[model samples]
Target chain A: MKIAFTTKGREWQSEMEPRFGRTDYILIYDEDKDTLIIFDNCEAKSHEHGAGPTVAKILIENGVNVLITGNGPGGNAIEVLKKSSIEVYSGAIEMSVKEAYDKYKNKKLPRF
Target chain B: MKIAIASGKGGTGKTTLSVNLASLLAQKNSVFLVDLDVEEPNAKLFLAGELLSEEPKYKMIPKWSEESCTFCQKCVEVCNYHALLGIANEILVFPNLCHSCYACSELCPTQSLPMFAQKMGTARHYVMPDMELIEGELDLGEEQAVSLISQTKTYVDKLLLKDTIAIYDCPPGTSCPVIEAVKDVDFVILVTEPTPFGLNDLKLAVETMRVLKKPFGVVVNRYDAQDDRVFAYCESENIEILAKIPNDKALAVLYSKGALIYHSSKSVKCELEKISCFLKSLTCKERA
Candidate 1:
């Protein structure tokens, strides 16, 4: 299973972004490979109207089964995620990537 | 000739200037007052007339046909707004983000993405005693305003005469909607107050007009003779101060009652006459 976390850095301890669409980086954790890969998502800054749809498309293309994010993906992003198999778990704002991942593993994170 | 009355900040009397000017000018000349502020068109509220016609406006959004799809991801790649997404066996189109540019639909190799009309707003035509009023009202939750404003302008253009003057009451701010509203106008009248926020937004509006290379000026609304920031800015920028509508409780009371202050308030009438002269000068320049 693959899981994604919106992060501020490439490290596991990097702070998770408080917003989903405009996150600076996206970190994917692969359970099968027991490895972590990071993708640059700084293009969200330049998006004027809708940033959620494209960003959600990235998570879908990367085969993310679960997502831990913050305040939004907005409505347009939510539309894309709704059609995918990715389960959304929010309320990860202000937490480190590792902490959010741990909370997800422990079933302490709220699922949306 | 077309003139758009715009303001960067809201509640600075764009509609007041538009309504009074249109009412006054329509007495001796043919005039069309179009409320391009689709999100909240209040120009119609101040003008009474029969609803000659009302029609729904549409925006061309893409409809994905799965039968003709090869999953080539061409639609997703061509969309500048990123409104389309291609996944395993399915393609998604987010209508909210779509700009209706037809780039994706036209570029699709298999005709998988076809343009479909989606209702975005309604355009109403009102015939006042001497002038005609046209306004576009955007549907609730509509994400963008440029398309509606453009469609309304096209509708108004068809009904305009060669000598008819067009006055557009534009939406506030210096954004895309405002840009589209003032795009083809011959002149722009930016209404602003004398406060810090008003001056700040006025500067942004001035920059937008400069970038568009349009002949424009400012009209100081609710003129506080004590404050000199707006006057100083206009003078320093070499911008003409077209008219000043003085601050008065009597004008405010009449405006609140949806009364045309052009006939009710003498001070406001004088300001409208000054704006009228400016419009006349523009016509003279065109003739010369």
Candidate 2:
């Protein structure tokens, strides 16, 4: 399973970004292999409107089955993710991407 | 001649000038006042007239025919707005994101995508004795102000009299809708107040007009003689100060009541007449 975390920076040490759509970076963790991949999320950073669904599409294309972030996604983006059977969890705010992943593994984060 | 009254900041008296000027101009010539501020059209509040006609405006949006669709994602690829998405066995459509560019339908490989009209807003027609007023009112939650403004202008174009002078009360700011309202006009009256915020946005509006290569002049609304910053900037730019309406409490009272100041104040009427005459002179100069 691939889990995505909205982050402030590309590395696992960077703090988890509160925003889902306009986050600067997304850190994807492959639970099976215990590997990590970082996406810059440049389009979300520059989008003036509809950033939520656009970023959601990017996550979906990256085979992300779970999204962990500090804040919630927009209504339309939530709808799209729900339709795609992707689970969204909100928690782990002010913590690093690696820490958030640890909390997710512990099932401490709240699912939306 | 077509003239647009625009302001970079809201509450700067674009509608006040447009309604009064159109009323005054209608006394002598056929006039059409178009309120292009669809998001919050307030020109009708000031004008005393009977509603003649109201028609709903529609814009083309893509409708997918799933039976013929091959799930190739061509339509999704062509949509720049991300309004379309090919997910699994179905295509998802987000109407809010669609720009109605028809590119998706045009790019459909199997001709599976069709176009349909969606209600964007309403175009209203109001009639007074001397002038006709056409206003566009965008529906709540509609994000296609530019398209609706364009539709309103196109609707008025067909009904225009041979020598009718059209005045467009454009929306505030130098956005896409403002550009749609002011584009192709013979002249644009840029209204601004004497303040830092007003001047900053006025500079942006001026740059936009310059890029459009349209002839435009500045109107200093609520002008105070003590404020010299706006005057100094206008002088440095060599932009004509076509009119300066003094900040008066009586005018504010009339505006609050949805009444025209020119109708009750002789001095305001004179000032509006002078501005109208200046616009007429520009028309004559263009003809010559």
Candidate 3:
């Protein structure tokens, strides 16, 4: 299944990619892809609101099934993802985005 | 009459002003200090107090039972918040996106949707040395903060009916929650510092108050910041400069340790007295 990780823009591009173990792929607005491409959201800018949501929307439109995040599933971004019927894991601030995806896949994460 | 101290931006000393001013007024009258900064309520720290109690409440959402749902898109069509969606198998409900409007339930095809409460968070009331501080804390995963703040207002109004001298320390942003807290107050003290960010945010906050038709004045904290933009904006708008607290590192240190400035500074005591008198005059005008 294609997956995307929703993150604060600052965390996306940091050199310290905070050990995400479950999901290997990241979502980014690649110039070559011309739309949001699932490569690594780490290619996106830091602390921006539009960049992450834009990428998430692109990923969802491109058939990404699951999206992982650090905070609870509330906010404008969550609203967008809910419309697409993408399953979101709300509690994952400590673990990496990939780890959260694994936990959700393994049924370790509770559905909100 | 209750006077709320608020800033458009965070970390601008709104809490410090409210705590000291409330403490100063509590000496003569029964003062009730309400910390409406639900995001990070820190007003109780300045006063020697413990949380009296807390109760969890919810932001109501329309729940649809799949058995009765006939795949009619009436609920989806009526939902302006886009909270309800009709998938192929069933109708989906997004709780976070819901604005608690029961239109979906009302417009349900088979009347399957019912409005139910979801736990939002708790509102804690604390009694301090000279004041009662009330705070409403939203749960970590909750999206509705305005509802919790409204609950705080309801309880404060019902309980503190005789409290003629109440000080409300409102949230930082000039958003829905701040508007909810300031709506019924008699007076608002717009606390801001003399910085670019301060001035910009002050403009937005003042615009909001003006739109609400609430009578308000400006309090320039950190008056020694060498920025005159706030003063210029206030003067142009004819907003009264009620008081100016200079850049005092001692007051900052006291605040860092959750202490009221009036406890340590003699000048703050005098400044607060002037503010109390100013509020009294404003209240008298409203009464007259």
Candidate 4:
């Protein structure tokens, strides 16, 4: 299963963005392949509204099974994510993407 | 003529000016005071009127049809509002995010997404002595004020006739609802105060009026003789200061009691008269 984290930069050391919808990039971790995919989310960041649903769509399109981010998605996006059956975990706002990933692995992060 | 009273800042006396001006205007001519601030419409509270009719307002939202078979995700792709979600056998529709644009419904390949009228708000008509009041109030948690404002305007338009004046008590701020309120009006009256927050919002309201190319003026409410920032700003921008309803404790007391100040207060009446004179100069186009 692949997991996604909202982030500021493309690397593993990048700061985990506090904003889910307006995050600069969505870093996808393919656990099976041990590969990382960076999805630029600049358009969603500048969107006037519905950024959450837009990001949710991005997650679905990228086959993201888990969404690990800070301050999880809002109503509209969360509705779509929940309907799509993608598990959302938040509380990674204070850590880096790698740190957040490790926390997820260790079951330290909580489901949103 | 349709004269919209708007203020970028809240509590700048848009409702007070609206009710009083409509009252003052109704004495000589037919008047309609429409409170388009659907979220918190309170103009009816100040008027002693009988309820004529109350009607629910609806806006079209796309409804997903599962029986139509093709789950090609065309409805999801065309929805600009991101209100639609298509995954496997089901297509989720989030009505709150829907702008009722009809793009998704119209573009759906198998006609699975059809438009449905969903109740969003209500229009209550109240008949007073000389004037009438029509205000739209949105249901709690409703997302778009612009749609309801437009719906209210359309409802009001049907009730209006030639040579009568319609005063729109618009929502606060220089946002979509404010735009929808003032966009088609014959003139715009921007209510403001002398304080910094008032002036800052006044500038934004002024910019909004300018952008819409609407003939507009300013009405400084709760005016203090001490602060002249609003005056200075209006002069620099070449905007007419239509009236200045003084900062009076009596008016506040009356307003808090849900009483119409102009009916009992001389100072407020004087200011409303001044605003009336300016409004009389502008003419509304004859109905076809």
Best by TM-score: 1
- DockQ, candidate 4, comes to 0.50
Identify the leading candidate in terms of lDDT.
1
Q: Which sections of candidate 3 miss by over 4 Å? A: A1-112
Clashing pairs in 4: none
Error of 1 at A83 (Å): 2.2
Give per-residue CA lDDT, model 4, range B172-255, as digits (tens): 999888888988899999999999999999999988889899989999999888889989998998999988898989889998
lDDT of each residue in B1-288, candidate 1, tens digit only: 999999999999999999999999987899999999999999888988999999999999989999999999988877778788786788888887899999988999999888999999999999999899999999999977999999999999998999999999999999999999999999999999999989999999999999999999999998977889999999999999999999888889989999988797788889889989988988999999
From the highest DockQ down, the ranking of the candidates is 1, 4, 2, 3
**The best candidate in terms of DockQ:** 1
Better of 2 and 3 by DockQ: 2
Judge candidate 1 at residue B155 and give its lDDT.
97
- Candidate 3 clashing pairs? A10-A47, A22-A98
lDDT of each: 0.91, 0.88, 0.73, 0.88
| Residue A69, model 1, lDDT | 90
- Candidates 1 and 4 compared: the better one by TM-score is 1
Query: Which pairs of residues have clashing backbones in candidate 1?
Result: none
Model 4: per-residue Cα lDDT at residue B121 = 90
Error of 4 at B144 (Å): 2.5
lDDT of 4 by residue, A1-112 (tens): 9999999999999999988889999999999999999999988788777788778988988888999999878888877787677899999987899999999999999999
